[model samples]
Target: METRKKILITIGDPAGIGPEVALKAFLQFHDKAIVFVGDADVLSEAAALLKLNLAIRAVDSVSEAIFDKGILNIIDVGALRGLSWQKCVPTAIGGRASAQFIRCAVEIILNGGAEALVTAPISKEALMLGGVYYLGHTEMLAELSGATDYAMMLTGGRLRVILATIHTAIRNVPDMITLGRILGVIRHANTAAYMLGIIAPRIAVAGLNPHAGEAGMFGREEIEEIAPAIEAAALEGISVTGPHPPDTIFHKAYNGEVDIVVCMYHDQGLIPLKMIAFDRGVNMTIGLPFIRTSPDHGTAYDIAWQGRASATSMAEAIKMASTLRLPTWR
Candidate 1:
């Protein structure tokens, strides 16, 4: 039997599907000591909507919580008693609640109360309206944890993408894609593979333009910046290769020629990752002090309380967190 680890989960946006999917995931997986940090009322209301008889026990502290099958232990951080599900939509209150839940979870991890954290989706617009300036989980987590060199890694099935630049404007990506940034991402990607038990992992770096700038005809970002980063990573014994064409590198990844693909921009990597692992992709932050993972998708406000949301990604996030916490067998 695998040793049980304490896993902390944050209900991202109370108005979104975070509560619903969180409830469903815990109902399925009962091995680890999972603590759901959010508004208890939101969780109960979601359970009621699903017509499922789930036991939601409130705990004053992380240590007081019981981790057993058939019970969803919660540490209520927000007072969502009077808030209706209808008002849960991207309002300031909902955004504040979501931010509160996230901060509470981070505190739990920082204080040595939890081994890992699994966050649900949060709305960016809601976060702004609630007076939180962070764009999303990655940026907020990096700031709260005081991590200077961190990268966003997305994993699903056999495909893994590590972004060189995330949450930036397309027009701004080229300027941000400096030699140091690409080299930093490569280092982070190496660390991530090590955590996943993949020593000597084959790393692939994608190009910034068609045919990798056609040897500097289309663009020089690849020839000038990307190629140098790959060379630097190879010198550090990373088994790195690329400046491969963005169009065909993914195909190589799918066929097992690559273990992780390093991309220059956001859509360059995610467009293919979501296409392959739409339902079960897991977003992980590399180079943090503690292990962190979340469902790759966002808050589906359109189907928040309709009982139509799929919990596959949530369950996978929980599973990935648990696995990452375990001592690597290899």
Candidate 2:
């Protein structure tokens, strides 16, 4: 029997449903070794509120964890005290705690202590409030892990969409979408598909303009930028077809016609993905040195403590993180 790979899970915000969903997922996959990196007190409180008698064993190190069924091993960061699950709030302490837990989980993956990482939803505002100056998890992970060119790929069962530009202003997107950027995203999409065990991944690159520029009648971005980039990627031996109409490409990809769709902009890709699999989507970061994925949704502050938050996305993320097997680079 092979040993189960340990996955480092970070509970993003104690005040949010991160702890709850993580606890629930762990309970469901009790056979796998999951190291929860967050406030142990917060997890215990959330478990109590949900009427779950889960044993959160605090371990000093990941190796010390006894991989057993029906038990959760935690690498407690000691972020909160007297954690109240019912009265959860977005406090400075909570924000700082979330940042610290993320840092710890990333470190564990980098140092080879964990096989993969699944981060819960974090608040961009709270993260900034905690004095960490980063837009979101993708940026922070890139900087921390030294990943220069990384793309965000959202996966929901059948549909997979990769973004060219993420978390940038709508007006600034045009300037940022260059030939290099488009090719980089396509390359990452191919690599991500391969990691998911797909050989010779077929990628459909979405055009920036309507109707794929309608032969330069609608817009010149596809004619001048996107089409050329796709041509360049094809010459490199990647199975890529390109400059497809953004509107219809996602529909085809969702139906399994294409392995992945490389979208030109953020909303151009995410709008359809969120519509189809908002609750079950997993946001995976490609071109990173380490494997990193998160649930598609955000902190969901309105339903943080109501026990109304669904764990399906988080559960899918955990399962994906566990299944991803990276190759040994020479």
| lDDT of all predictions | 0.87, 0.84
Kindly report which residue stretches of model 1 are placed more than 4 angstroms away from their true locations once superposed: 1-3, 79-88, 325-330
Pull out the clashing pairs in model 2. none
List, residue by residue over 1-330, the lDDT tens digit for candidate 2. Answer: 437887899999777889888877777787677888987777888888888877888987898887777577899987665553334556666678888898888888888897788999888877777787788999999988888888999998688889999998888877877889999999888888877999878899998888988999997888788888899999998889979988788879878889999987788988888888888999999878777889998888878877778999999999898888765550
Q: How accurate is candidate 1 locally (lDDT)?
A: 0.87
> Candidate 1: deviation at residue 144, Å?
0.9
Task: List, residue by residue over 1-330, the lDDT tens digit for candidate 1.
Answer: 324678989988888889888888878787779999998888888899998787999997778887777888899985566765454478777778888888888888889888899999999998898899987999998888788888999998779999999998999988888899999999888888888888679999999989989988999998789999889988988888889999999999999889999999999999999999999999999877788999999889988888889999999999988887332431
Q: List TM-scores for all candidates, in order.
A: 0.95, 0.95
